[model samples]
Target: MLRTRRVGRGLSMAVCAVLTFSFFTACSRNKTGSSDSITVGVVLPITGREGKPGQYQREGIELAIKQINQNGGILVKDLDKKLPIKEVFYDDTSDQAKSAAFAERAMSSDNVVAVVGAYSTALGEAESVMPDRYQVPWITTGAAASTIFNHGYQYAFGTLSPTNLLGSTTAEYLGTLVDQRKLTKGLKLALALENTDHGVDYGNGIKEWIQQHPGYFVVVFSENFDLGSPDFSGLLQKVKSANADIFLADAHLQDYITMHRQYLQSGMRHLMISYGARGPESDARKALGDGVDYIFAGIWWSRNLPYPQVKKFNEDYKAFTGHEPDSWYPATAYDAMRALAKAIENAGTLNKTAIRDALRKVQLNDSLLPGQTLKFGANGQINTPFVIVQNKPGGKVDIVFPKDAATGDSIAPTPKH
Candidate 1:
């Protein structure tokens, strides 16, 4: 009887311990659930030609994330919970193949709710296929090609103005300068562009605009060059020989630095040299050192604008990044994050379809760009305004065109280098 009672007591103790362990395990799993964090995947050219801009964009996104988290995270009405954002990043290396692969991985392996990436048009084109296939909403912060929007995919969206709009807006600004300020009349135009979609689209837009206004411009030279050409001396000589009053070049940041340096060194003098979409980069200033003066660029935003929203964003961004925000990339990425948060809140769940549907219906008003309201069209493209900024003496970039929004007067015939 004694032996049997002892055995029974041992069995009872073992059963109690197992039950306690099981109960605690179940409780822990429930407490630390997948709903605790929201994952957002970011893909960018952390290497190659776009490396610098990509780094800038990443920093901006991180700053937005930090600010959002500090504000008590994103609220989920369905779950009645707050979810912190988790960023899963991949380097596309600015390669098309790598971009496609990264997109696949971001969608499948990371299982991210949405993706932000592909700074270049080439990379954007390559990665676009996967998002539609996977039904993931892909927000592009830098790629501005119209083809990205024409693909008829509801899942893809770009925060930047399309190249067509950028090109025409730039030309229109130049026309205003010529007509109102009498900077130059019957201007002779020259075009030099990189051999990429970015170049082609801008070139087409310019051609269309010139065709629309025949007597306003005379095309002296139209040419395209390979990106990252080590020396732009040959190109600069061609541009000089053209002797066009206004020279327009569509190039990336590195190319902008290289070509402009070569232009200044080669003593090319035009009444106006407008660099499309490449002037907001600090690299240009670093490389040229006063060479960038008098050059105008079509941009999406500028810090010098006098507005409460602009001031607040500039101060907050400077506090976070230790530098002022550039034209488009960072602001676009920041807007993307805020838009994503709104979609998540509206959807009330982490379901991709619901989030996408909600995103399509949402209208973003707190954008950094003035007079611009962001709403996704059925085709997943954002319609926004473009601004013109001229680099003034002493490293000041002031908004000179769009008269109603002008921050300073136009400085034309930039002092000869």
Candidate 2:
């Protein structure tokens, strides 16, 4: 009986050892740090209000990853091998707290070498702190608020130029119209800015330009509105009473659609209308039809850009996504991923610190953005110029500013609706 008991105990020990080995083997396969691939984390508002633009950015990032993997992935010198990227992606659902939490979770739990995400100014602001805290590299694909970079964080980088540039660029474009006699000087401008750092920077940009070049434009009315507000009727009534010749508002995708729909319904018309970086979007067009026409925006990139690489990118993006991008969202996100990839290749290792340092030094000459080069400035934001684009009747969009890149003339003092 003692011998039989010993045999049973031996069998049980052998079974326990096998189970433990299998458990660890399964864990190693599931973990991102597995030797098979390099891991990167992506946190974006894939659902909720910011979902559309965030999805576009995700498409761009995925396209880049697909292309890189097809080319045998990135080379890691330390490993002496090329490994495909394995992404641990999450949806923040456009919640500010979720954005930060997801970023923290990615850095702390996923073992990702780097992360890219949080598409809006507010969301980006929320997630920006995680990079420095976790000692991971973060690249924001969409946020442009200057206040974000002013925090002195070393691990954070962004592809969007400052919102102030977007503002000043809009003012410069409008000033050009005044100089060419397309519009008369001393035009009164009514501003409906979103209540965020983005809006403040935009308002300041226009105000600064007006101060620098007097007699060009005047601010007749200015007001800020909460984001995602349902009704802009009260605001539109005030703007209507302002009697401004030009209407300018810095807004997000949904805000542009909602506000413009109300603007048209209220019969408030201006000589010119702009929604900061929010014109020519397919969703806006689908929402407002001809209502979105004659609107101009100063944006980071356009499919109308005249470059072989830009053309190729557009084609590649379309083939991969089954539809063309209607705004600047995807282009910036695509470049952000490419920039991160280039930095990884330059670092030649998955070391997070090395990747962060390499990001500061790497530059992409084949960038799809204007100037065809992507390089981060001292504050870790790109300083590329914004191109002004206008939507015309029958669904045509054209670049109307910077004569060298202009595909069509600006229809200043827009025709009656």
Candidate 3:
């Protein structure tokens, strides 16, 4: 029998649930009858603070596997035949230690070819080691911190936008607005960011841009808040007291929901507002209603982009999951799976080493991301830029920055609270 454990939510993240691969078979209450299946391991925080997006990543991975199997599965030239993918899903429950352990099990115990997992940088960073130790390729669909790639690991790979760009892009876009006089110069800027590597990178990137471009904005107040906080009144009070002209907060979905509620209630408004990567979520829009409108965010992918394949993917994703994507989480996961499949095909063999080599040389052009291509850099992280999105009234999302790909311009000086 596979062991299981229950964990509680942490300050910045939630609890963890450990479900061994056997649970995947048990969940469906069926046993596989063939050894022809190509096994893959999937670890996710399905029950914690990052659970919502983790579930989204899981759904996206499953959808891609279903499509791949339906289209004749994966070709193994060694056997001159195709094999359907069989996934063993593990619930890391937002526990980093448990995540790595389960990943180790997936490789050492379960005979999986490769692994896909982890929705947050913390968890992804934790599990990054199992790939190289077990000599299996690990593809991370959600983690984006550059630190995960800093270590010399040959087997770890990611499929999301890096944090530096996520922050710098937003800052650059804002600086451009101020340069055009659409926004005031030397405006007071307030920073409320999460206390994590992801948050640190975001803050550092923004601050670096500020240093490079003189006088576009001034950091009047800056502070880091613990993730998963239930209240933000104290923080908002400080920000309001500072009377910053712009407010930038880096947070997760739950934090975004909680803080934004208190922010509006506090009657603190800025010439521009951003919640870092935490804004533009559908749940936030429904929970806060018009409160989220006009709020901008730097994001990985938005369905509103003009990319032809992206448009088609929105339709296919809906059909596959019976729901529209909530945010950029799924798109990255979906593309990651496709990239893996393409690598397997290119390798022409099921040999793990060969596939790993193939991944290094893989370049996917029929992708749904803005870049229109997905290729891992030498450090195993993808080179991609984020888009700026604003939540418009009537539940519509628009691309507001980087005029070349923008669907609409930002509506500044957001309506007074």
Candidate 4:
């Protein structure tokens, strides 16, 4: 009788251990299946010098999220279920340090699968390092500096094409104008660029173009200015003395307004004026009135693009945001979000490594940029063509370059003031 009782007790203990192990295993499976949402992180400057553009980008990201959720979120093959995206958004207040910090917090604390952020080149540079450190994918909607991608980091990507392309495209457009006899060959050019990675790339691109096509242009004057200068009178004086036929500046939106205001006040005029990617902002129009007219910019996206996707995006964006996009800022950002979402779906799981790998293969077929498709190069940057848009009188903007996509005529030689 004693042996029988002892054996029965041992059997009872073994059965309990087995049942406990099975319970935990079952819970693990349910945990994967019952995930409420797939979380993504977003960090952007919503309130500083970069604020206006940043806000537009934020809206673009939010709009894409809304659309994705409306469709029952992304489908994950591992879970055999669809999970809505839960965005963990933060404002870096236009500070580069803060941008990096927020990105770190998102990955370390919020457990985000991916991050999108830091709109400008400088800010993006600050946040770019966080992706590889945390082993999460990051996509920058605005930054175009090539330095960010050359670091051998596998997790970082960008929607904006390299800044050098903007410079080269501008040179190509001007060369065409010279070819058409609208502008003369050997025209002296003046470059006033913002001192940053962006500026360096822009200047190099122009010089490379000039080197390849000798006699098309001459860099009679080239100078760099500190960003957000309270006064540009000193620089403007030097540019005026250069007596160049073309004045090209790579400036942010605010700097464009301030510098142009100073340029107008200083009575400086060039046959052709370009502010890199700054011509069509409504703020510039409001601040400079008729002065901003005839200015051209090589930008990543334009509302003037003639595509069905672009038209739908414009209408949908206006309805969602209660205002039309001021420029190319929002479109790149919107595409960035869509690209990330596509990557997640392609990954078919919330695994960070899988998503990072999948991002390399994502191809957005209905992209709203100059090209209808969006794909990343080996460097994880998009190599889309930049559209050169010129501001016309009475608030009209025209796409003048890449002749096939021209929406309105290029007012070459820009009717000297």
Best-fitting candidate, scored by TM-score:
2
RMSD of each: 6.8, 3.4, 9.5, 7.3
- Please write out the lDDT profile of model 2 over residues 1-417, one tens digit for every residue: 999999999999999999999998777657754877988899999899999999999999999999999999988998999989888899999999999999999998888999997799999999999999999999999898998999888999999989998899999999999999999999999999999999999999999999999999999999999999999999999999999999999999999999999999988889899999999999999999999989999999999999899999999999999999878989998898889989999998889999999999989999999989999988888988899999999999999987889999999888989
Which residue runs of candidate 1 sit more than 4 Å off their true CA positions? 1-33
Cα-based TM-score, every candidate: 0.89, 0.94, 0.90, 0.92
Which has the better TM-score: candidate 1, or candidate 3? 3
Q: Cα miss at 191, model 1 (Å)?
A: 0.4
**lDDT values, one for every candidate:** 0.81, 0.93, 0.86, 0.92
Global CA lDDT of candidate 4, please? 0.92
lDDT per residue (tens digit) for residues 245-274 in model 4 = 999999999999999999999888889999
Which is the better candidate, 2 or 3, if ranked by lDDT? 2
Stretches of candidate 4 off by over 4 Å are 1-34
TM-score-superior candidate, 3 or 4? 4
lDDT of 3 by residue, 9-99 (tens): 3322331223455566564444333448788889988898889999988988998999999998999877789988888999999999989
lDDT tens digits by residue: candidate 1, 40-141 = 889988788888778778877887788889988899888899988888889888888998999888887677888987788888889888888998888888
Supply the TM-score for candidate 4.
0.92
Better of 1 and 2 by lDDT: 2
